[model samples]
Target: MSVRVQADPNQPQAQDQSFSAAFELQGNPDQGELRLYTPLGSTAAGIQWTPINAVLQAHGETRQFRDLAQLITLVLGTDVPVTALFAWLAGQNQEVDGWQVDLSARNQGKIAARRMAPALPAELQVVLDN
Candidate 1:
């Protein structure tokens, strides 16, 4: 699925890195691949991860990560609750440890969530293509 993520810099955990990216992620959060592209549709990076090994390819170079969290945090500048994403995408309001999700518009192919407890509160919005 295609997604656009916006990280608020005001969030303490955001570490002053305000990022916005449009990317396509495929596979399951447990074991899957993600391809991040430039707005113009060129590949910026690609990541494939499994329980044992995770690899990220970018800038014509490939690097291996010890785990998915590290790989994703390195790329996105923050750790996203990927496991909860499956539930969110399915229109289920599953709460992560520090995040609150709103799925009222699931039938409309839209959902939004936010981090509430953590010092850094960031919002996530998703719109699935019909």
Candidate 2:
């Protein structure tokens, strides 16, 4: 876990900024937690955290994950690259897989379940990758 402190604008149209701290987490496929603290509100999702050899249970079963980034990409469908995903998850610098994964129907278009990649693993990864 890590504390992310930064200036956050209260509203989209507001012209003010405040210091915010987000308790971020990184884990493998099955479990992870992302709890963010801001002056505005709490942004917590994907809280089941794991790592290399991290085991996650979903759909009535337990599974193993490669690393923390892949877990989020699988859960969120970001399709992050192998090299990049590694750098982010392993903490080569200071960022983890960061992206807004909007998997709405129209945006997804004709993308089918078979098309999404290591981006989606087994029944979990490709469900959105396609």
Pull out the clashing pairs in model 1.
Answer: none
In the order shown, the candidates' Cα RMSDs to the true structure are 3.7, 16.2
Residues 54-127 of candidate 1 have per-residue lDDT tens digits of 99999989999998889877776567788888789877777789888888888998878776656355667776
What is the lDDT for 107 in model 2? Answer: 42
lDDT of each: 0.75, 0.36
| Lowest summed lDDT window (length 10), candidate 2 | 121-130
Each candidate's TM vs. the true structure?
0.78, 0.27
Best by lDDT: 1
Give the per-residue lDDT digits (tens) of candidate 2, residues 2-50.
1112222344553322222434444433444544444465543323544
What is the lDDT, from 0 to 100, of the residue 23 in candidate 2?
43
